[model samples]
Structure formats: C-alpha cells, structure tokens
Target: MSKSGNPTLIIASFFSIYVIWGSTYLLNKIAVTELPPFMLASIRFTTAGVLIFILAKFLGINLAISRKQFLNTVIAGFLFLTFGNGVVVWALRYVDSGFAALEISAQPLIVLLLMRILQGKKIKLMSMIGVILGIIGVYLLVSQKAIINQENSIAGMIMIFMCMLSWAYGSLFVSKADLPSNYFVNTGYQMVTGGILLLLTSFIFGETWTSPMVWSTPVQYTMILLIVFGSIVAFTSFNYLLKVVSPEKVATSTYVNPIIALTLGWYFLNENITVQSMIAAVVLLTGVYFINTKKKLLIFSRFSGRLSKKLK
Candidate 1:
C-alpha cells in the first residue's frame, strides 16, 4: 500500500471530513443572513476553485485530463455542487437550519438505494437494514419538535430534498465516471465548473445585491471559516477519502454530518435539542455502522480464505 493508505492518514482524512463538513451547515446558516444564498454559494465555490487551481499549478501538477473525463467531471460537478449544495443555500432562506439539515441527512440512505437501482450493485442485507433504520431515524429526528414544522414553507422542504437527491446521484456518478487521475486537478475542475453553474443560475433567477459586501461580525467570521476550512480543507479531504476508501464507506460521512450540525447549531445559535434528536442520531449511526461493517467484513473473510488455501 502507498504511504497515503496508512491508517493514520486515513483516520485523519475521516476526522477532517467529519469536523469540517459538519461545521459547514452552521457557517452556511450564518452566511445566508448577509449574503443571498445563491450568491454566497457561488462566491464561496469560486474562491475555492481558483485557489485550488493555482495551488495545483504551482505544485507542477498536469491537469490536462481527456475530453471524455472533462465532460464527466463537469456533469459530476453540476450535480453535486450546483444542485446539491446550491439548493441547500437557497432552502435555508425559508427553512430553519436544523430542519434543512434533517432533510440533507437522508443522502446516504438515498445513495444506497440509488446504487442498487442505477448501478445494479447488490445491496447487502446488513446495509439494507441500515437503510431501513436510517429511514426510521430520520423520521424520529425530523419529527422531534416537528423538526420540519409544517409552517416551514413546503417549497423549501422540497428544494432541500432535491438537494439530497442531487448529491446522491452525483456521488453515484463519481463512482462510475472516468475522472481525472489526480485528485487536486479533478477537484479544481469540479469546483470551478460547479461554481460557475451556480453563479449562472443565480443570475438567471435575478438574485443580486445593490450593496457592496456587508456582513454581521459573526457572519464575517463564518464566511472566512467556510472559505478556508469548509471549501478547501473539507472538500479536499472528501476527495482524498473517495480515493482511498470504498465509496459507500466514504459516504458514511453523510450520516455523521447531521450530528455535527446539531451540536454546532445548539452551541452557536442556541437551537434546542430534544429527546428525539438523541434517539435519531443513535439510530442513524447504528445503521451506518451496520451497513459498512458487514460488507467490509465479508470482503476481508473472502480474501483470508483465498490466502489460506494458497498457503496450504
């Protein structure tokens, strides 16, 4: 195995993704108050893309991927960033941050099912159980304090659900697509392409601002933090994990991000946590563990059996 595949690097990647990504929801919430959600998302990604692209060049990385690979990356980028994250930013204007989170948390379960339907992958029984548990967990999580209050705009809820679906499809496509061999170059293209799409959509929808940037103190800090940690560090780590781990395992971050969002929301915004929140977090984590572990173990056992026969 390459040095990058060592357990320490893998564990670091996991933590980087969990902590940074989990924190983004709250940062996004803060940014939305001062910036039009679409505009903010566009700027955030644009900045990140430019920075990454510059860095890749300085490091002497050749990003001259094939035309077919470029097209696939563009499609993946549009699905993931433009539709997935862009919709969330827009939805936040109408929905509570926590409620928006609960909806997005459904992504892993949705991805699991989509892989079965679209990729024709066999759904292991344990992972299927995880999916079932996750559904129940989501019900409990959202039902708590009516996580999504009916008073919350129905349009907002639908948009966030669409975000989840977009991310799911994008992730599935990433697994199948012939992407760039280098992680940094591919991510750079994705960020740039996706951010441009986001900006174009925002313009088409007439989302604009008359004032030069003005943000509340907390929002300003949040924006900086998101640009530095969320877009750069977290996204890079996510791409790294996708390279080292199985996609399904990397996808487990979806199950974990909500918990991080819940904690940060309660800490920073004084959002209330409920009994149901605890229950749902437990169910969802349990489900994720079951789904990933069983499949991993099965593969390990098969490898071990083959090795034993050869040794004998």
Candidate 2:
C-alpha cells in the first residue's frame, strides 16, 4: 500500500484504472462499429477536456500555462492521443478488441527498449530476460494462423504496433519535457489539443461525421461512458495513483486490463479468445512484470518518485 492518501481513495483509484480503462476497449469496439473512428475519438476527448477544465475551475486549480509547456502538451497530445489512440480505434474495425488490448499490453516492453536505445540506459539482467520473453510472446500472438488469415488483421496489428512505438516515444519525451504543474490541467490541455488534431485528421481522411442525436443508442451510451469514465475519471485516478503509489504497483493495471478486455470481448461481443492468445497474454504479462520489477535501484527510485510528484 502507498504511504500517502486515504486507503479507500487509493483502492478506488486502482479500481478505476483496472476496470474502467479495461472496459474502454469493449466500449470503443461497440462505438466504432457505428461511428467514424477519428470523429468518435475527437468528440470524446474534446468533451472530456472541456469537462476537466470545468472541474478544475470548481476545484480552484490554476490553469495558466507557459508557451513552452503548451507546446510540450501539444506534442505529447499528438503522440499519445492523436496518433496513439486514434489509430487504435480505427484499427478496431479490423481486429478484435481483446486482441488489440493484448497487443497493447506489450507497451512496457516497448518502453523498456526505447529507454535503452534512446537514453543509452542499461537493461538489467532481469529486464533482458523480460525482453526475450516479450518477443516470444508477441510472435506467438501475431503468428497464429486464425488471426493472420482475417482480412486486414495484419494491417491492423502492424498499425497498432506503430502506435505503440509512438506512445513509447511519447513516454520518454514526457519524462523530460516541461508541462503544466497540475496533472489535471496538463491532461486537459493534451486532450483538447489531441482532440482538435484528430478532428483535422478525420477531415483529411474524409471520414463521415454525424450528430450525437443520430447515433445509435448503444453508441450514445458508449460515448458518454468513454468521455466521463474512460477519459476523465479513469485518467484522473491514474494520475492520482502515480502520486500516492509506486509506479510498479500502479502498473498492475497492465496485467489486469487485458484480462478484463478479453473476457468482456468474449462475453459481450462474442470475440474469440483463442488458446494461443491466452498463452501469449500470460507470457507477455509475465515479461512486463519482470521489466517493472525493481531491486533497490536507489537512483531510479528517487528519480521516479520525483517525477511522480512533479507530474501531479
């Protein structure tokens, strides 16, 4: 348990990320069936961003940001949301939501390797083992004949992997970039900017747009849930957890989210959860655990602790 904050709040925060974020895959899958992907993401983030600013005002948090910080937020927004999330939503049209979630679960592995390549950081022996296992797991997951045989499945998988790279690079950039001191304010800026960019992308791609009133009932409900819970509430909890708990502990969401996604996809969407995917998920999550596990690296602990505090 974390040494700070109420235990109940901490538990609730964990639940938000573990379950709410996990369920987003299913919700998005449902929505994208009826709505255009980029347009859907644009509306969700824009609405959520506006709502966040309203909440911040109610809380009396400062929203002023420097130009440099604004630029950083835009860059982060593009990498994390515009490209990273928007493309994934688009790809969901071609791939199962569970499979997409499972593939994204390898993000930790991507981040670890990115740190090594970009920052010249040394990978510990345990992390090296994790890298090997992650590669094998990914191979197992993507190599299955059933998945590859599906139309556009290969394209979807490839694009999702590219989005992971974008997200991984964005993670590295944010660790050093200057941004709003308040996490809520910072996230609001990112959401707004990212959403705007997504809207532009939608226009460029000639995606059809429709009013919320005309949307199907399920899509309407999904959009509301996505904006309220997935983007705002869950993200707030994620930032809160980073402040109160060790990141490795917060990262337990990585393990639980895909399980929730897989089960929900199977139950609600009738998406297949093949035996190979299950095996890959286990191996991949195990590798993520190994990569996140620490052994008294005082320097990293101090750095991450400071980063977490500053991020809030």
Candidate 3:
C-alpha cells in the first residue's frame, strides 16, 4: 500500500478498525451466551488463521519464519490472544459488553505503569496526569452499584484486569521481538498458535463442543462476523492504516472503540449505560488522549503502535 493511498480507502480502513473492532465486544457477548468462551474463540480464530494463510499464499506472501520467531509468536499468541482475548470472552458471561469495553479503555494507563515498573521508564508530566485521571475513571467505572451487584462481576472485572496486564506486556514484548516481517504473516501465526492454545484450554476445562449446525442462527451469524470481519478484515485494515497513515491517526480507534461498543451493547443487548459510565468514558478517553500526546521521550506511543495491532 502506498503512503498516499486513495482517500476513500483510508476512510474505509478507519471505519473498519473503529466500528468493526468495537462491535466485536458485542459479537463475543452474543456468542458466549450460547457457546463456551474458549471454544467459541478457538473456532473463530482457528478458522480465521487458516483463511489468512490461504489469502497470504494467494497474494504470494512468504510464510516462512525462524524457529526463534515461531517461539516468539507462540508466546505472543498466548499472551495477546489466548489469554488476553479468550479470557475476556469468558468474562463477558458476567460483565456487560459495554462495561467490559469501558474498563479495557484504561489499557494505555496500564501499559504506562508497566513500562515504569518493568523498564524503569520515566513517565512524562502529561502522562502522569493521564495516569491520575485514568485511576479515577477506573474507580468510577468499577465501583458502580449496578455493575458490582451482578453475580461474578467482581471476578470478571479482576480477570479482565489481568488480561490487560497480559496485553500490556505483550505490547512491550512485540516491540522488541523478532517476528515475521509481513504483518499478515505475523498475525496468521499468532492467531493459529493462539487458537490452538484456546482449543487445548477448552478441552482442559471440559467445555462442551457442538457443531455449528446446532447453534442458534444469531450465534452462527455472530461467529461468521467475528471470524471474517473481527479477526481478518479489521486486522488487515489496521496494518494498512499503520503503513499509509501516522500511528497517531490510526490510534484514534483507542478512543472510538469503547464508545461504539457501549452504544451497540446498549442498543442491542439493552445493557444499562448509567450517567457515571458516560462520565467515566469521557474522563478515561481524555486520559488516553493525554497519554498519547506526541513527545520526544514518549515510550507509550512506541509500544502503542505495536499494541494496537492485536487490540480488537
């Protein structure tokens, strides 16, 4: 893709990552209602991974990688997709999709903190303010009576937080890891490895597996969308945008995704959106914006460019 791509294509790619990626929370919520979380995620990703390989072959993209790169991809797949994504799907059973999206919006904050603790990176003044507001926003979001009152919600929230840590560390790891040069090839390896791990998890947990034929129509449709759009199309668009536009411009999805997820969950699942949630969303997104402000010493943006690749 050229750096100066067609304007219409640029707009469409942005739409894919912003809207389509956001809707995945709702899609997972709907699917998890009928299928076991790991199983659902396994099926979706394994199929998508194979499809990606086929597409890469057709496009004449090389699929070979060193053993070291393969191992790194395995680790990354486990961190980013197997645990980061699959566990969130499990959490969906207890938490509302919108609520989950809102909570996950604090990821940049977590990444910043991890960088400080792990790498001894100094946080900029603006990023420090973002951290403070992010904390308040998170407290406001999770402390809601309506949300906490739900059974298992606390566990779900805690697990989701752990997943954020996994993703944050994964982001840091990916920045330095020697992986496939082609984005498509890298993602294909990660999805395939991650999907295999999820399959193993499902078996270990004794989650019942059933044929798609028996799935409800809505669930079948959701699976199709998740596999085709959520995993494949949105990811492809993300890579395209990263090549054609500035990372800062592509990073706007960080702010837009949660809002889209919240709206869709409210409209389709009738998930309640309290006034506090709205307030928290604004504050949280503002914090993210502040943290993402361009700076010479900003490590967040450097890792974030890698982070956004796997964040759907």
Task: Give me the candidate number with maximum TM-score.
Answer: 2
Model 1: residues with Cα > 4 Å off, grouped in runs: 1-6, 144-150, 210-213, 295-312
Candidate 2 lDDT, tens digit per residue, 44-97? 998999999999999999899999999998998899789999999999999999
Find the 10 residues in a row with the least total lDDT in model 3.
242-251
Q: What's the lDDT of the predicted structure labeled candidate 2?
A: 0.87
What are the C-alpha RMSDs, in order, of all predicted structures? 5.1, 7.6, 7.9
What TM-score do all the candidates reach, one by one? 0.86, 0.88, 0.87
In order, what lDDT does every prediction score? 0.78, 0.87, 0.87
**lDDT of each residue in 1-312, candidate 1, tens digit only:** 221466887888888777788889888988887788778888888788889888888999987899998898789778878888988888877766665675666677877788889879888767888889888887776565454554655678778878888887877677657888787778888888888998898899998753435667787777778877888778777777776776777777866687788888888888777777777778877777767686665876799899999999
lDDT of 3 by residue, 20-92 (tens): 9899999999999999999999999889989999999999998999999999989988997899999999999
The segments of candidate 3 whose C-alpha lies over 4 angstroms from its true place after superposition are 1-15, 237-252, 295-312
Q: Tell me which of candidates 2 and 3 scores higher on TM-score.
A: 2
Off by over 4 Å in 2: 1-12, 239-252, 295-312
Whole-structure CA lDDT of model 1 = 0.78
